[model samples]
Target: MVAEDDEINRMLTHHQLLDTGLVLEFAENGKVAVEKARANRYQLIMMDIQMPEMDGIYATKAIRLLPGYAEIPIIAMTANVFSQDRQVCLDAGINDHLPKPVRTEYLYDTLLKWLEK
Candidate 1:
């Protein structure tokens, strides 16, 4: 899966999973993320909310509309934890939301939990 923007967060997330042997791709913005996700088969997608050209919420919707990505899980990673933000992500068709500065344990748990569904 591709991580969109927030270099430090991406690095920490990637590093934390290095031992797991998961190949991660990075994109600087939602546009690139959308492109990459469509270019390959991703088990999941983790991305920041704020990005140039396109935002995570919008990208998530676009991805959902894509031919083969309707059921693919796209988890929103945002600093905003407001109920409205959560609702917005949900309304946009995102399966789940994770706050920024994501902890390794939570990431692993969320992925496992969602993948099991």
Candidate 2:
């Protein structure tokens, strides 16, 4: 699952993930992201930190509370790279942080690191 509000980012990520052979699902905002999560099981979630309806942190927290989702990997995909922002994501139960303008190599690496688990 990829939760992102910006169309350009969404498209960019789509293209980036195209060759990975993963069936991707998209949510325009965190509320939709949570809804999708409740309805389906995804191996991993790439979540944007700043989104309308609900932010990634809250969505992650809400998803964490859902049955069967406690151990699911939810990674934050965001431009917020400050130490405190990273800490906030950690506190909210995000498994990892992927800084934005997401480089292809790091994206693959992060996916492998989490999905392999």
Candidate 3:
């Protein structure tokens, strides 16, 4: 699952994951992401920090409270790469941080790190 406000970022990820046979589900805002999460189980989630209705941090925290989602990996995909920003993401219950524009290698690596287990 992916929670992102930007169409380009969502499409880039869609293209990148096409070959992996992963079915992509998109949420344009944090509210939608939480709604979708309520209905399904995802192997992993890619979340954008900035979004409408609710921000990624809040959405992540909300998702963390859902049953069976506590151990799922939720990765932050954001332009903010500062140490403090990353710490904040971690503090919000995000499993990992991927700085944008996300390189193909790093994205795949992060997916593997969480999904391969």
Q: Tens digit of lDDT per residue, candidate 2, span 1-117?
A: 999999999999999999999899999999999999999998899999999999999999999998899999999999999999999999999999999989999999999999999
> Pairing residues by index, what is the TM-score of model 3?
0.97
Writing each residue's lDDT as its tens digit, candidate 3 over 11-82 gives 998988899988889999999999999999998999999998999999999999999999999999999999
For TM-score, candidate 2 versus 3, the one ahead is 2
Q: In order, what is each prediction's RMSD in angstroms?
A: 1.3, 0.5, 0.7
Candidate 1: residue pairs that collide: none
Tens digits of per-residue lDDT for model 1, 23-109: 788878888888887788787788678887999888888778777888888888889889999999899888888887777888888
TM-score of 1: 0.92
Show the lowest summed lDDT stretch of 10 residues, model 2: 66-75
Runs of candidate 3 with Cα error greater than 4 angstroms are none
Best by TM-score: 2
Better model by TM-score, 1 or 2? Answer: 2
As for lDDT, the candidate ahead, 1 or 3, is 3
**What's the ranking of the predictions by TM-score, best on top?**
2, 3, 1
Clashes of each: 0, 0, 0
lDDT of 1 at 2: 53
